[model samples]
Target: MSHDIDFAQSAIRTIKSERDAIDKLIPRIDGTFTQACQIMLNCKGRVVVVGMGKSGHIGNKIAATLASTGTPAFFVHPGEASHGDMGMITADDVVLALSNSGNTAELVMLIPLLKRLGTPLISMTGNENSALAQAADVNLDTYVEKEACPLDLAPTSSTTVSLVLGDALAIALLEAKGFTPEDFAFSHPGGSLGRKLLLKVTDIMHTGQQLPIVSLSTPLKEALIVISQKGLGMTAIADSQSQLLGVFTDGDLRRVLDQELNLHTTPISQVMTTQCKTVNADMLAAEALNIMEDHKITNLVVVNQQNKIEGVIHLHDIIKAGVV
Candidate 1:
């Protein structure tokens, strides 16, 4: 066979082997999965992950996923644990140990110490009957049909199944804990997701002197000037008490032109939309975008409890805030 042809065949075989391994894992997600999730959910301290070699790499990623999703967790290398890292694991913590053979020397050595600390032990193992599996309070079987490696020496498909299993457990615990996007944002305040969920209308809305407001008695021509000055494509009309009366938008101008109404002589209140949608200043910018999209409008008046216009927020502002 040509070199390229042989390489392609090898790649395809590897992919198919991994696919079958994951398929087999689907049936293994049962009561044992729920049992593990319960232990993590009830854990008040943290999920202490321990693993050796290739499993340690996957364990670190699982720890990160769990920490960001609501269940606080951190990884402890099994080799290091034997020296002094074992002190990081506490009685209030739940230990999640990973071992393909379920008898990794570095990790199995910690079983007695974990038991002494009175910590709940959950193990992920390929061999269900190995020492680690038998010693764990709850054992998650990460068995696979075969490794993707033709020699069956490298951890290929086994690592993939183990990583996916860790994600499933983390998400299950996240759902059970009533984790919300707002809660997740708190965990990742520096990320784009945090900005989208945590930023409120007031944070981006134009307030006070920047607001483009016209009185209900204002002429349509003058209101157009206000809209042009604010450049928000719209202007709000209020009563003497500053209570919002209606809104005159560029769309309304189109409808007015259809009737051949003279802007210079017309009153803005005559053509303004009285039922304009408004959002609270404290509402999330993402939620404001949703309201604008639902109403098919680009601008929203930010209001207070008294129905007075506190500020204005436009689709552009939400987009600029990276909330779109």
Candidate 2:
């Protein structure tokens, strides 16, 4: 076979091997997984994750997932833990240790100190009988049939399985705690996903004098001028009390033009849409986007619980907020 063909075949075999490894890991989630989740869930302090080498990389990601999903977690390098990083651990913290061989010297050596501090240890190892697993309060078996590596030396399938296992644990705890999207947003405020879940119409809507608003008795010509000045493409028609009466838009102008209505003389109330869709100021920005798309409209009148005009939210506002 040519060199390129050999390389392609090797890549395919590696994928197939890892796929089978994950398939094997499916049946490994049992009471032990529950026990591990329970320990971390009931932990008063934090879940401190530690691993050596390749396992350490996976542990870092696992720690992030756990922390984002409502479980407080942080990763500490096992090799560094012995060199004074163990001070980061405490009596109230639970330790999650990952080691494929289960006899990794750095992690195993700290079992006694963790015990002395009365900190619970959860171990993920390929071997159930290994010293680390035996020393742990809960053991999560991450055993795999074989390595995807051709030499069976380099870490490959094992690391992938460990990551998948970590995800399972994080999600399980998230559901157990009734974690909500708003709760998740608190952990990821800088991300677009967080903005979508956390942002409200009140956060991005055009309010106060910036709102394109006109009285019901105002001429259509003047309402169009308000829309042009505010640049929101729509204007709210309200009463003296600021109670929402209706909405007039560029689309309303189009239809009025088609009907040969004179903008200079027509009352805006006669041309405005009385049944316009509206959203509460407190509504999630994402929900407002859904409302706009569902009604095939671009702007919504934001109101308070009293149905008084609060502000207006445009499709552009939601999109700019990264909610769309």
Q: How accurate is candidate 2 locally (lDDT)?
A: 0.92
lDDT for each candidate structure? 0.92, 0.92
Where does model 1 exceed 4 Å of error?
1-5, 26-31, 82-84, 128-131, 178-199, 254-267
Error of 2 at 67 (Å): 1.8
Per-residue lDDT for 139-158 in model 2, tens only?
99999878999899899999
Clash tally, candidates in order: 0, 0
Stretches of model 2 off by over 4 angstroms after superposition:
1-5, 190-192
Q: Write the per-residue lDDT of candidate 1 for residues 292-315, one digit (tens) a residue.
A: 999899999988889998999999
Q: What TM-score does each of the candidates earn?
A: 0.83, 0.89
